[model samples]
Target chain A: MSGAGHHRNAELQARVNRLLDLAESRGVITRGQVDARIEAFGDRVTARNGADMVVRAWNSPEYRERLLADAGAAAAELGHAGGGYSSDIRLHAVANTPTVHHVVVCTLCSCYPLAWLGPPPAWYKSEAYRSRVVRDPRGVLREFGLVLPNSTEVRVWDASAEARYLVVPQRPPGAEELSEDAQRDLVTRDCLIGVAVPRLPAEVSR
Target chain B: MSFAVGDRVRVLTMNPPGHNRAPRYVRGHVGEVVRLVGDGRFPDESAVIGDAARREDIVTVAFAGPELWGPDSHTGDRVHVDLFVSYLEAVGERSDGGRTR
Candidate 1:
């Protein structure tokens, strides 16, 4: 069934399109300019760039250290910073260990690490998930079918400021033998977000 | 502008006029700043005017579960939230005590 929020968003989109059309007709805005703006918006946050950063951190300890020490520069080193809508937001990387895990959330709104991880999924923006995760992270993770061992410490990072965060999941065992490109393929978006760890070939086969 | 990394501060719950990055669930909670994350143009003013707002220092804050959820909350479990300078107030100086949740 159609929901009120969805309907409102559709109406807003229509209004924006009409305004754009009028602006174009009046010579105030060009179609090419509008297309460029739309393209910019889409390119503003990209997951592929983020995945590359994760892969680099996985392979280069120096880059990883720099990422942990100063995330903004680490991202800039790869040409992922300073995009539209993302100019103000900063990115941070958190490394996971055998005993600890990290997850990202935006309790108030859908702020995400677009520079490194791309746009957030629909589930990330839902009020149900947002409101519940901060209060009961383990229970919510359980709902996602991620049951953590009692000994594991689950750290939740609430992305509230213009600053955003990405999880640097530990490289899976046996990944050492794989080429960097192959290893990058293993660093999925979920791995970057700390929802799942990088899967080894054997694990993937299973 | 008012708080820095390592400073202990509490979130204010008042209805702020502009874009706010603070979560409602964490309003009135006390936390310690873990990292000074640099600054950015504030969102509130930027949204109104097409121009980028002036940059302010951003900080990463660490909050113990007990401070947010009382004594029954898991001991030693902590959460980190990145906050803008405007969303926070000094712990004892304000009378409202960040109650807006």
Candidate 2:
């Protein structure tokens, strides 16, 4: 299924269009408002915000301490406070240790860290991913091209509550030689989600 | 009842008639309290009563893969779930009907 609600079945599309029309006619909300909201989210709340946090944490131990303690406030300090429509939303940062790795999923629905990461990917909202990731995390990570050692423990986080999860992957070696902007580029969305780790340019070449 | 971090708790095996946040797979499984994830409005009650429901404590519980899915699961994998306190109970006391641990 498309994450942006595109290419759906015609019957479902028609029903959704009817509901939208009815709501617009009753002054519930306008199509323009909906478009504006999506645009705002795309522009302001993209995954780059999460990359920025990870990059900052990579450089500053103080900021990393603050982020792990109060993720919501730390995000807000960087101007990425993204609760959107609910005051109940909270962001939690789970750091990867030498023996432990963290990956997040929402089993019931597509609940994600939308405030910091903007919209979720199409695969994240799929039934196959939601059902299988918790059961066979290593298999799923393998499919994503991540092969962890048997000694390393995989921790699959099933997010069923209002709190959102962000994975803080270990910084790649030789990251200190790069500029801040360069470091940010290595911290991709996949790295932030813990499916893949950031790789230095030299490491990638090797 | 309140539980400190590192306490062992088991999820209640329940199939309630209304909306609930606890997933079916983790029901009746044992886990350790990893962190207290703050309180929020109870999903089951809030889904029925809307804004009038009371808030409840939430925690991040970590369960071994083998404990949840049996021996076929990965050897060193663990699953962490953010669950309401109401969905948990003393682990050893449930099946045996013995005194609370």
Candidate 3:
């Protein structure tokens, strides 16, 4: 016995349809263009773009200096030029050192570097992560299987503005023996976000 | 720009209507401008106007844990938030004194 008391879903659908029609009529965007853009984003952009930047920085001190200085330009050097959605948006890189760890979050909204890092993960957009990270970063990192020593300072970066953040995890031990591609594989999205650090496959196996 | 790098400033506790990028947590908090983050479209305006919004200067503000929270907070812990220039105010001697959150 379904009641007609609330047509919330239907009403929302109709509103969405109306907005789509209006946008199409005004040439704001076409369905084909939208689909094409999504497809391009899925195909060309991925976390690998960010991993490439990290791997390059880990190997080259000059690249690391440039990345820490002008992250947007450093990304562009690797052909990951962001700033499509907002003409003024920039990418900022924070490097993790022996004594400090950097983690990023957008408390107000999911203002991620989608152009460079691809779409944000489901967990990233969740309210728990958004609200909890700023309040209890160390606990959140610990829950994520990352336990930091008391001496290591945790720097929580609240990306509340247009500038997006990328965390460069500290280079792992014995990483010098790894090839460029192998090193790239070590740097995952979580490593870039500072929730987890890169580990050699052997380390994980052991 | 109203403030430069190394300038000690306080984030304005403004509750402007409509969209805003200044997070509620950092409002009225004292922090130092670490670096100029370049100019960007103001979120309060761009959140309404997609492409026509004017750009404004942005800076990465760093706040100590004890300052943002309290004495109970971790001693060496620091938090950094990128903020627009307009959201920051110049601090004078003892300007932040007697201003209780």
In model 3, the Cα lDDT at residue A147 comes to 88
Full ranking by TM-score: 2, 3, 1
Tell me how far the alpha carbon of residue B70 in candidate 2 is from the true structure, in angstroms, after superposition: 1.0
lDDT value, residue A135 of candidate 2: 93
> What is the two-chain DockQ of model 2?
0.86
Q: Clashing residue pairs in candidate 2, if any?
A: none
Cα lDDT tens digits for candidate 2, A1-206: 22444566787889989999999999999999989988998798788999999889989999999999999999989998876577887899989988999999999888889877778888888887898889999998998888999899999988899788999988888988999999998988878777889999887788
Ranking by lDDT: 2, 3, 1
lDDT of 3 by residue, B11-79 (tens): 898999899888888889998889888788887898899668888898989888888778877767788
lDDT of 3 at B4: 84
Candidate 1 structure quality by residue, lDDT tens digits, A1-206: 11125657888989999998899899998989988966865876556777778788888999999988878889889887745665666678888888887888888778887656766777888887777666666777777656778777778898877777888888888998999888888887777776677888788798
Which has the better lDDT: candidate 2, or candidate 3?
Answer: 2
Query: Any runs in candidate 2 off by more than 4 Å, and if so which?
Result: A1-9, A202-206, B92-101
> Per-prediction DockQ, in order?
0.58, 0.86, 0.72
Stretches > 4 Å off in candidate 3: A1-32, B48-54, B95-97
Clash pairs, model 3 backbone: none
> What is the TM-score, restricted to chain A, for candidate 3?
0.87
Whose TM-score is higher: candidate 1's or candidate 2's?
2
